[model samples]
Target: MDWITHEEDVWFEFRGNSPHQLVPGRFYRGTVDGYADFGVFVDLAPNVTGLLHRSELDKRLESLTWEPGDDVFVQVKNVRDNGNIDLGWSIRQGENEFRGARIHDPDGEADNQPVESDKSEQTATIKTKPVSGKRRHVGEKSEPKSAAAETQSVETEVVEAEPETEETTADDESRAPTASDVVGNLEEETEEAEAESEQETEEAEAESEQETEEAEAEEAELPERVSLGIIGDHVGDHVTVEGTISSVRQTGGPTVFELRDESGVVDCAAFVEAGVRAYPEVNVDDNVRIVGEVERRRGELQIETEDLTVLEGEESEAVEQRLADALSDEARPDAIAPLADHEPVAAVGASLLDAAEAIRRAVLESRPIVVRHTATADGYVAGAAIERAVLPLIREEHPRDDAEYHYFTRRPLDEAVYGMDAATNDVTRMLEDRDRHDEKLPLVLFLGAGSTTESLDGLGLLGVYGAERVVLDAAPADEEVAGETDVLVNPAREGADARDLSVGALAATLSVAVNADVRDDVSHLPAVTYWENCPQQYLDLAADHGFDADRVRELREAVALEAYYQSYQDKRELIADLLFDADEGLAGHVSEQFRIKVEDEVETAEANLEARDVHGVTAVVLDSDAFSHRFDFPPTALLVDELHRRNRDGDRFVTVAFGTDELYLRATGDLDFRTLVESAAAKAPAAGLGAAGIREGRIEFLTGAREEALDAVLAAVAEQF
Candidate 1:
């Protein structure tokens, strides 16, 4: 169908179509909707709303008489790249003002159905599930009943459908109301109800017996069973699969049952009403046989179940025997050797094995994994390494193509410590998943954090819920942290110098230990974690694994920039493309952005540096909130770190960047961070100054006492020097 351009002053109205059918430059009748200070929003169709700017109004906005639901005319001005529609006020308020009024349509195909009529057509089969290629109304059978019943089967429905009202007039009350008349009607209704009850009970007993006999005979017939691994081959064909239900989740459209057989696992969907749970009798761990038609939904294979019947006796035994092999084969594999002969990687070998085994066992048992890491280049590489490794294993273990979504997740923390807020959020989500989706508890893995005393409360909160925790830290760890977690793998715990090791290198080692098949994909990850002075062994591995030094820096910079924006989210595919599959030049383009943004920020910060000789030590203080890009890339901490990196002329100079209530310190020396904080707190007791952590090199103080805190900290630094 060809669309024609209409002449000027032509107007249109939308009946119930979406914005996809809308045409620009044509006037449309709409109702004034959501209010705003700048303009009023107009609803042209159910899902389409356009903003009519105040500048387009013919009269003052306050003086306009239009209320919500008032009919007005507007012309489509433009559609934004993000699908927002801009509308201009039209002077043609009445249909007679336009040259012609037509309905905006798609390809000239008119939609003439009323919205109310469409809703009414769905009433009879509203709450139903399709079985045997036919819709079966829930709570109502098709069997013939005695005509002795009332118009409605349920009392609630009867009252709602035909509400009783007093119709007697003042004069008619004297003539129409005898108690005897009311009593007589009540007696008739009571007798009919009793008979209706008796007939329904008899019919139900007979139906139940008949269904039992039919089910037994049907089972004896034994339809051919299809393996879930090959279910994709039978798309649109009805087939049976013998399995045990692993989990049940009620979605908005259907009740999805995760069915696992010896071949693999798949999902079977049965619908009843919108948001209504279907197959209520089917539960997790129940042995059953399902018959459904194979289908592909969003590129993932699924089964639309027509019938789900529980199996007992001989049938149950057969299902158990069929699934025996798949169960036994899920045992954890032996951990692989580290990628290279690095002391830090080999120091925590025992803990690495434990971490790898726990991950593999979680996959085999159909448990979900939640990874927490700081939003940094090293952190993302760490998370993505495990992410890339576990995703393929999930796909292979479960028959469903979407198994990875159900099994794995990675969340980035803005702070170095997993505070109570992050723990509460994780707990809330896991509890909801368990109660709503019947999923198992997730294994919480901390990639670079959760090994400090500051994270103790958050870790303890997870422990209360019995969530298994694994903490892999490249930083030095507190001894108490080892007691709170299931596995703590830190180079400091093994007596190795954890100062030089990056989280990315340790995580990639653990990723390979989890699955050795993708060793080549992760071989270059360790080298990308370091901006400069990367270990020789990691560089050699990167060269051997097909990533040159330039490519490694490109991947590293790209992740750092993307990680700062939306710091709490793991942009999975974007990072995956940069790290693993950047044959399409995505890395170079993003890295270029990283360099530009950082360079601009660094130049601004350098121009405003306040250099001073405080307490005989060279101190450069930067008022970060006033002079730096506080909300953009190169976070205050990262910017200060970068500033110190570029301007640390010698070992005597220390970079100090202060915000409203916090200050960051960076220096290369034998200064003890703990002693410095203690001395500062002793001098300015009212400031309440405390070191955030040694790794972050930050100090937290009261807002009112910020000046005193800075003075005290500078004096303490002199003592350390």
Candidate 2:
């Protein structure tokens, strides 16, 4: 392209076709074709437009004063294989500023030839290159010239190249061609050339799009597979992992699958639709392989599943066997040692091993433990011992501080039975936690409770939801209830006297088995359970640690008073302090209050006691409805325990404290509530007397037959005597 000075304006002349006229690194005169968000598009040649991107601009696009169709000077930055032009802003605005005003002529036989000009005498020749790889000179001698001389030479070439049609039309004088007519002809050619360029660009884009799709398909075929243990290192990396589904939970956005392999467990989330099941056939404990990208959400590592497939037959069996082997090797304790030297505690040796294994598995599998115990001093001691032992293990196993509180809970039961009321509360709360927080279903444990037939319904409800159950009690556990629980630790099941072994003793033994580090802290708990007739073995163990009878009693009283204050809460820290920590005045102060409260209630019950001889047995019947503080501290059950302890002589004695709807009996003689309820029901056929809670020595009778029930139960006690 060559440029000529026409008056004050500069005009461009193309010596070849439009495509070859604009060469890379050459200056060209162009028009401001249009404005766009990115930059300004300039028409450099007839059909060619180049982008002057915002980055390449010397000044702000908004500050540019050029309008559409206004001429501007630009340099060709690049010419792509697809014929796209990249333009750069040039500060040189006039044609004279360019060296020699060189023009590329593709059609010239001699690339550049001298054309003597009539404009200026101080002339310089132009040296040019042809598109066919030939170089020629415009004059005999070619050299660099001043800007004015270059302007003069460029004007000479333009005049000599003027078409013959312009000269002929000028001589006709009838209708001569004007300079405006020549300009109009060039504009028509430019419009046609632009249409051709646009068509070529569209075809090139279509080919690029096809190539991109093929590349993505190839990438999908080759995904990296990794193990669960190493998945954390590959966060944000797409990988595949194979394992068995340990659990499944559906949330608002995705279905979370707990994928457990030999190495570890990771959650794989699949989103098919909001709250919709991703793989309907997949269930808990099924073997499957998941392909997903590892990601961290809310500070926990998760896999965003892109594909999931269920394994069957040999593959599924292999996965399950691998996981079973890993669990057996890693989670199970190598050996079991009895926590006590007593025969009753040692009799259930296999059950203790099973119990420890269950607790260990719950910790390893990340299942929360729900411990329910009776709300008595002994029960609190037992529950607190397990809590003390398990919480430290939970903290050691998990990194979170609140994991102990969140994953392990010890709830106090009013009585030693998993009654329907307690079960309902547990079910409601666990279900709410599961649904609202995506928590795993907890392993329900009953210590000092849920070992009798009375708790069968409660255990069965949890069983219906596939939850695991563990029962550890110092009571005569029913065979049916024992069959329902995964682990049953009961001395009675091994033909030992359950009455001699307090629940606190049994639960503390289990606690020591769960975590050996807390054994010293919980050694005195068994002695705290017995108010009188403390076991010689446990007393000796406590005495070895300076916890004499008085100290043991103080611990019991402190726990009992604290238990009564918050009857529902476990009061974990307070109970732990009283039992595990040093005897630091807390027990002494609280024990004095417990003694005063119990003595006051006992003195009042003694004044109202009605003693009578029924069938040669002394029956000290106290109307708990009239004398006892029916709604206040020192509950009827505890009061009867104290009354029986204070008033029992060398004769057969039975204390029957009947309330509004229930009966509380604590006997010094050989009168088991289980036998009394059976014998009393035979005497009073209408009273439906039954053992309501064997551990608490409670019996149930129809309120309508209260008088008959009392008489029949008294007669039964006399028969036992």
Candidate 3:
């Protein structure tokens, strides 16, 4: 056999050649062949025999009489190899019991079965047994027993036997009696028995009713309703009423309370007395029921409150809830403090101005001034620069309506003069206008380069319109002047004339004027001669063939010192180039001074030397040789204290350079160029030549030899100048 298995269905088939069959586990339906008290015999298959146990029958149906030779549907519960099978003889097929039993027909023929009317009566009788205490006739008894035993035995036997007889009697009673007189007789007897049974039931029910009435007469009863007012009255002299607190007042010591309910506001005192703190303070709008003694006073009943408990109010409750919820192990109680005081705006601004003024003064006194000024679109002006002379003192200064205070530079005039003329023109205009209106210009000071001096001057011209100039020498070294000037000239010797000088000498002299310290020995120096000695005029000639003579004289006196002028020109030139490029309006004039001074001084010196000592000579000569053979060195010295005092008060002395026939000579202090040059000859190879013709001298030299010669020349010039 082969079986095909599907998800929810299975099919069986025989695969072998021989015929084969399969049977369900143990049970099968069959027809009853015979019956006995123990079981019924059935034919399970074509030749198989089975037994249906009497116990398997419906108990009610089994008591009813049944005959052999009946057809039945039986289930085979078990099968034996000996051809015995366990069968179930049920009046119903599987799952069809409620529809009624399937009664078997005898002789395998439907005609041999009982009629419908008979079958109905039989089923009804089998389903219902007679109640206990019923009697039976003598012929109904099929077994024998003693008196007590007979009664019990008879009752049990009659109960079992009654269903069969009663079924037949009921069928007969239900139908009209035919010519079969036996069925009619059975029905008549059954009716008479039923009538007697009805009478006995009625009498027993009447007796039960009498006993129930007697039992009902023996039980007990419960209590009645009463009032609770007698337990406690008026809450022991305090009246507690529920109401919302509408207003609260803190009077004397305690909070006086007033509450509102549906009727009206109830006045309640929170304290026992005016200054007593008996009850807890209550906040406004608290819903509460206060208990207190009602006392008569001032023609009114006042509540001398004992307890004022709040029922509901959010104002205090919310605060309390927030406080409680915020409570944490890490919370700091002292973290918050009350604000002390605050200052007015005017006071703060005044303090700030005072402090700024103090700092400004300190910087002006101790450091160089570098001013940066900004002019607003609204005509407000501000600036910064180095300090020179103190601003002129004036009393009760008043400014014009269009005027505003501005800061200005205080650097020395020489250094300030180095700034561009246009920028200085602006500063001059601003200062003059401001002074005319009696306005005070603000000032700032700094220690480093005043690179923006020209810009400040320009702003001054636009705002103040006065002759304003930055003094660069006031700063340490030539730091401030280097920022403004285009070309820095370092003269080989002091007092060299700017007009007749070679370009190198002219360049060196301008650098010295802008950044030198003055000495007493040079105190008698003529300002014009010193101006003519600087390189600025040569630079001017190179740029525009014109020099500002008045400006040069002013600068000579302003710088006024020798050592201040001797710093390296290379560093100053770098600063100047960075600050003022050639394209700037002021840069052209400054650059002109540089180129003209270097080229002209070199040309003049060379021409003068060629015409005199080295005429037609192609070989180079040293300045030191000419100096040594000519003029004698001068003696120049002064008291150090006196010199210091003069410098402190911004006074400076100068030297004069004169071009003579034998050699160009410089006179400053007690020294002359001739002696200085002779002294330098022992150390400087280039020192033996005239300063002007040094560049033309050619000696077989290694790398850096020319540069060393140049350095030597410069050193000698610095000492002599």
Please tell me which predicted candidate would have the highest lDDT against the true structure.
Answer: 1
Once fitted onto the true fold, the runs of candidate 2 whose alpha carbons sit more than 4 angstroms away are: 1-319, 434-438
lDDT for model 2 comes to 0.78
Tell me the tens digit of each residue's lDDT in model 2 across 147-216. 9877756655342255569768777777877899999988876665666557658878988888888867
Top candidate, metric TM-score: 1
Per-residue CA lDDT of model 1 for 1-721, tens digit only, reads: 1123543466666864556567778788899763444677788987688888778888766556675678888998887766678899887887667666666555546642211224435655323222222223357577665654333333223222354457635456658657998999889777766677677799899999999999899877655689877887898888999898878876534578888887777889876543467789877778898988887654578888879999899999888877765655553446558888889888898889889888976776677999999899999999999998899889887766567988899999886788899999999999998887888788999998898888999999999988999999998888988888999999888889866688999999999888888888999999999866799899999999888988888999999999998888899998999899948399999899999999999898889999988766888889988898788888887888788888887667789999989999987566788789999999999998997856678899999998899899988888888
Give the C-alpha miss distance for residue 50 in model 3, angstroms.
99
Relative to the unseen true structure, what is the Cα RMSD of model 2? 22.3
TM-score of each: 0.65, 0.62, 0.16
Q: Tens digits of per-residue lDDT for model 3 on 339-371?
A: 111122111222223323333332221211233
Give RMSD to native, each candidate.
13.4, 22.3, 47.3
Residue 572 miss distance in model 3 (angstroms): 20
